[model samples]
Every structure is written in structure tokens, then in C-alpha cells.
Target: MSIWEFANPRKFTALSLKILPTLVGLSAVLVLGGLIWGFAFTPNADKFESTVKIIYVHVPSALMAINGWLMMLVCSLIWLVRRHHVSALAARAAAPVGVVMTVIALFTGAVWGQPMWGTWWVWDPRLTSFLILFLFYLGYMALWAAIEDTETAADLTSILCLVGSVFALLSRYAVNFWNQGLHQGTSIPVATGGRTVADVYFLPLVVAMAGFFVLFVALVLARTVTLIRERRLAVLDAQEARA
Candidate 1:
């Protein structure tokens, strides 16, 4: 089958339906195990102590917050280049999930920061950029809702996503160029070389991050399927009205 064939709403919806159960079930297991290990089983850190436990949820949410926008950027590019309706709707479906992830990151950061940074919030580059990322998600969703025409809404939001992605990348890499803030430098590296976090904590953190990824995928699949159904209903309603 062609790439565009998968872009069909009905086809994509059917595919998402078949895969969602595994995604949901496995993610739930991983998240439960990670939480159990991170909070209850693992020994307290030598430095941060019990407070370090927050990293389990915080790091995973932060990772997803950045990646979710990147996923939307890719979907927006696909929609812009190939005019794929499924891609557009998928991007839309992922927006609120991204928002929730961003919120969790910010909230957890504040919780972790109070004892570490001595403040609930700061003007740190990383923190500020994350706030901007949250705003971008809101604006993207608002633009989509305000426009009545799906195609036109998709077009405008795709442009917004392409533009907002520049800032999102900046948020991720800001610490490298700019002054490192009260926020700790990178703790987790994907390849597991030159690691900062201990293996015990890192391992569960990895599992938690993987669970978050799977959870995001499940949400996007279910939400995109809903959007596709709504689109079909709108089309049929239009046809019946004309008939």
C-alpha cells in the first residue's frame, strides 16, 4: 500500500484501533512497575535524598513535553507537504496531550525546585521556554477551534506549528548556549554513556519514560480515531442535507 493510502482517515482509524489495546496495556504495566520501583523500592539518593523520587515522573513528563511538539511538527510537515488529513488530525489529537505533559513538567519542576532552587518559579531560560511551549500548544488548539473549515484550520495550524517548532528546539537546547539556571544539567542521556543518574534510578526512569511514550501514542491513536469519526460524520451530514 502507498504511504498516502495510510493517510486515509478510515484506514488509519482502523489501524489505530487494532494497536491501541497493546499500547495501553503495556504502558500501564511499565508505568506501574516504574512507579513502584522508583518511589517505594529504590533507596534514597545520597545527594537529593527522598526528594529525588520526583524525577521519576518529572523527567518522563519533561521528555514527552519536548517530544510531543516534535511529533506535531512532523505531522504538520506531512500535512503541509502531502495534504494528509490524517496527519493534520493526528497533530490536533496530540495537542492536549502535549499540553498536559508540559503542565506536568512545569508542576513537577516547581515541586522539585522549592527545596533545590529555594523558589517555586524562576525566570530560567529552560523554565521560560517551557512556558512558551505551553502557550504554543494553547494557541495551536485555539486556532484550530476558531476556524470552522477543517482544511483551512489545518493549513493555518500547520504553519503555526512549523513556526513554533523553532522555539521548542530552543527550549531543549537553551542550557547549552545560555547560562545554566538553577535547574540541574542533563541527567539522562539516551545512549547511557557518561551517565549522571545512578543505574538503579536511571533504569526505572528509562522505563517510566518508555511508558510515557507509549501512553502518548495510545492517546494520539484514540483521539485521532475520534477526530476521524467526527470528520466522517460531518461529511455524511453534509451529504444527507444536500440529498
Candidate 2:
């Protein structure tokens, strides 16, 4: 009944495997549909013109990149407090996904920014913070790969994740912190009940963000399942060698 019950590797693996197919299918449909609608059907914006279309990919990915690190931060805290191997492994699994999302965001942002900002890159507060978050992701993954002991690796990486979260938080809020940045305000300001983007672009952008979130869940679950199996296999191999 409790959500924590699913923290057990066997239970987690079984449940994740069961839902993964649905998640995968839904993500693909939503992502493709949203992209088609946003890119093909929507008219150009008054200021940015066609370049504004990249929001379908850029905004979602940027949101995911920040939130993915937050997810890892939560997993890391769970691992630290509960000493759950699954939590640690989940954090590890999410790093690559987070990093890839960060890359896509950075690249797409550059593509979108060139025309608007008159340059490919700038040391804007938000952009700099996001870049720091990406570096932290790389460092976390490398720490996991470098340590031989699984528990030690998990402990270290969890700590690193905790530290990296500062950058993640900054990445999401740096634009607000510094008004001088070239980066504009949020496109979909749900909190304020007003949207800067028009309805045509807003609808598809929402769908794309939803799709990205679902895709992230599916990927993290799949990777965690694989890690659980690999850990079991390693234990079996160790036992056989001992025998």
C-alpha cells in the first residue's frame, strides 16, 4: 500500500517493466504529435518569427534538464537517508538522461538565441548556471564510474548530487535573479495565470513538455531495472567464484 514498498528491487523492477511499454508508447505519440503540430501548423511569431518554433524542443528540454537534476537530488537524499540501493542506482541512471537533456537544451537554445541575441552564446546568468549544472552531471557520472566499491560510489555520488543541486536550482531561477540577462521570462506562466505565447503555440508546447516528462520517467525506470539486474548478476558471479 505504501509507496516505499516499491523501493524493493524486485517489486520496483516488476512494476517498472509492466508500465514501461505504455509509457514508451505514450511518450512517442505525444512527442511526435506535439512536434508535428508546433512545427508544421503554427504560424510564426511577430518578433522572433520561425525561430520561435524551437520552443517545442527548447523549453521542454530546458525544463527537463533542470527537473531531472532535481529528481536525482531527491533520489540521492533517499539513498543517503534509507541506504536504499535502488535509490542510488536510480540517481546514477538519471545522470546520463539529465546530461543529454542539458545538451539538447543548450544546443537548441543556441540555435534559438543566435537570431534573437545576435550571437550563438553568452554568459547570461541562466545560461551559465545551466552550463554549470551540465558539468556537475558529467562529474557525478564520472565519480560513479571511477569508484570500484558500489556503496562507496553511491555515497560519493549522492553527496556530489547534493552539491550539484545548488547549480540546478540556480539554472532554473537565474533568469529571475538577474534581470540584465538576454533570456526572456517564462513562456507559460501558469502561476501568474497569463501566457506570453499565443494559444496555437501554447497548446503544442504543453503537449511537448508533458511528453518529455513521461519520456524521462520511462527512461529512468528502464535504466534502473537494468541496473538492478546487473547488480544481481554481479552478486551471483561473486558467489560462484567464492564457491
Candidate 3:
């Protein structure tokens, strides 16, 4: 069957419930297991020392923060073009998760930077763009919360998400665009087929990254299901009142 069949709320809910437990279990295993291995087993980098271990959280979170916005952008476009309620709700559900990821990334970056950069924060190109993306996530969620009309909220948030996508793109690419920034390059380079980091750090980091992505999917799926149910309950209440 076509993937779009999931656009139906009942089908989406059914599939989500069926897979959520597995996703949750897998995420916990990977995240917790990878982090423990990285912190306890991996050797400290000669340059950053023990502080480099924070990459397990910081890198994955930063990647997800950018990716989460891109996901919302895609969902928003789907809602705008297809007028699918599930798509809109999915975007709404993702905003909070995105914001939390942004916050974690920023906080961990600050903690990691203090010793390396000799400062907690800097207005570097990548950093600045990421901060802006964080603000956009806040605005997207605020726009949703402030509006009473669901369709209106969805429409306006979709526009906001579309506009905010520029920052998301910048957040991901700003390091490459502006090489002068203090932020280091990617640990794993896709195009180069080579990684800057060592094998010990690379394996755990990969596991952590996979864990973060799976965790993000689980959170968004759970949240979207709740939103769909809540919307259904609201409709039922309206119908009962009318009767």
C-alpha cells in the first residue's frame, strides 16, 4: 500500500501503537548503552581530554535539532498542499521535541566549549543560526498554543515553519559556509567517506546518533497520536453539546 494511507488518523494511530513499544525499547537501549560505553570505555581525546566525551549527547542533539525542523517543514508542506489534519498535527507534535533537542544541544555545547573556547558561548555563524532556529521552534509552538481555531492555528504555524526552515538550513550548513567560525567540522563526513574522529569514538557516536533519531521518532509519533485523539475528543464534545 501507498505510504499516504497513513494520512488516515485511524490507520496512523493503529500502526503507531503497534510499533511504539519497540521504538521506545530500542531507543533506551541504544542511548543508554552507547553513552555508558562512550563515557566509561572510550579513551579521552588528547586535544579536548575528557570533555570530548560530551559528543555522545551534543553531536546527536545538535543534528536532531536541525533535522527536527526539516521534518516539520516537510510535514507543514504536506498539510498545506494536501490539507491533511494528521500532517498538521504531526508538525505541531514535533515542535516541542525539536525545542528540547535544541536546548540540550545548546547547553551541552556551552559546557563543552567553556574549556576549549575559553568561553561558554560565542556568536559564531553556526551557533548563531542554531540559536535562531531554537527561537523559531518556540515561536512555532507559541503560535499553535495561542490560536483557538485549529485550522487557523495549523495554517499560521505552517507558514511559520516554512519561514523558519531557512534558519534550519543555515544551522546545518553554516559551519561549511563560514569556515572562520570556532565550531569544528563534522565528525563523520558523508562525502569524503572518511571520519575525523578515531574508531573508538566513532562507533559509540554512531550508536548514539541512531538512538537519538529513533528516540525522536518515538516522541513525535507518541505526541502526534495524543494530538489526534485530543482533536477527536474535542469534536465529540462539540457534537454532544450540539445534541
Candidate 4:
């Protein structure tokens, strides 16, 4: 079947049930393995010492935060243009996950910064924009809760999400655009001759990123299924009430 076929609530629910278990299992395995390797196997950084271990979680979560917002933006666009209920539901499902990821990124960053930058927090460009992204997540979710009508809520929230897209983009490139902080440039990139982290450390970082992506997908799928069922039940209850 084509991709659009799964847009149906029943079809999506059935597919999610079949796939969620496998995703959950893999996510658990990879995350555990990554943590062990990152913390125990990798040698301490010459400068940052063992505290560099935080990169395993912090970097992945930061990447997810931006990607999650992008996912919501795309889903919101589809919802508005195609009037797809599933798209709107998916966007709603992703918001909480995105918010949590942002929190993880911010918390882990602060912990890492304490030793590296000699401060827990700073009003730097990248950090400041990331905080704004988190607030955007909160605002989007709150808007949905405040509006009683689902369609109206989706429409309004979609507009806000689109408008807030700049924050996500800015969060990533902020360091490049403005040099207002001590945050180092990309460590994984070769173009800048960044630090050549050992494979033992880098491998776990890869696994952790994969695990988080799978986990995010599983959560979004589970939440979307619940949303679809609730929406259906609401329609049925409304019909019965009218009758």
C-alpha cells in the first residue's frame, strides 16, 4: 500500500501495534549498550575528564529537539493543507516528546558546562535560542489544551508552529551566526579539523542517537494511536448526544 493509506486511523493503529514492541526492544538494548560504552569504556578527555561522557546524551537530545520541531512543522503543514486528522494528531503526539528532549538537552548541557565553561548557564546565542525553542514547545502544547474544538485548535497551533520554526533553525546555527559564547565548534566534523574522538566513544554516541530516534518514533506512534481512538470516540459520543 502507498504511504497515504496508513493515514487512516484504523490502519495506523494496527501498524503501530505490530511495530511498537520491536522498536521498544531495540531502543532499550541500544540505549543500555551505549550508556555502558560511553561511561565505562571511553577514556576521559584530557581537558574535560570523565565529564565528557555527558556528550552521549546531550548531543543526541539536542539533535532530536531540532528534528522534532521540524517534524511537527511538516506534519502541521500537511494537516493544514490536506485537512488530515492523522497529521494533526501526529503533530500533537510529537510536541510532548520534543519538549522532553529539549529539557534533556538543556539539563545535560548545563551539567557539561559547569566543568567546561566554568558556569552552569549563559545567555549565549545557541543556548538562548534553544531556551526559546523549549518555550515554543510549551506554548504550542498549551494552545492545544486551551482550545476546546480540535479542528480550531489544530489550525491555530499549526500557524503558531510554522511561525516558530525559526527558533529551531536558529538553535542549531546560532553559534555560527554569532560568536557570543565559549561553546566549541562541531567535534564530529572534519572540515573544521575538530577533535578526533576515539571510536570507543564515538560508536556509543552513534548508538545512543539511533536509540533515541527509535524511542521517539515509538512514543509518537503510541500517542497518535490514542489520539485517533479518542477522536473517534468523541465523534460517536457527539452523534449519540444529538440523537
Report how far residue 181 has shifted in candidate 4, in Å.
Answer: 1.7
Alpha carbon deviation, residue 89, candidate 4 (Å) = 0.5
Ranking by TM-score: 3, 2, 1, 4
The runs of at least 3 residues in candidate 1 whose Cα sits more than 4 Å from the true structure, single-residue gaps closed, are: none
Better of 1 and 3 by lDDT: 3
Minimal lDDT window, size 10, model 1: 183-192
TM-score of each: 0.96, 0.98, 0.98, 0.94
**Candidates in order: C-alpha RMSD to true structure:** 1.3, 0.9, 0.8, 1.8
lDDT of each: 0.90, 0.92, 0.94, 0.90
Candidate 2, residue 164: lDDT = 90
Which candidate number has the best lDDT? Answer: 3
Q: Give the number of colliding residue pairs in candidate 1.
A: 0
For residue 182, give model 3's deviation from the true position in Å: 0.7
lDDT of 3 by residue, 165-231 (tens): 9999988888887887899888688898787888999999999999999999999999999999998
- Per-residue alpha-carbon lDDT of model 2 for 23-79, expressed as tens digits? 999999989988888999999988888987899999999999999999999999999
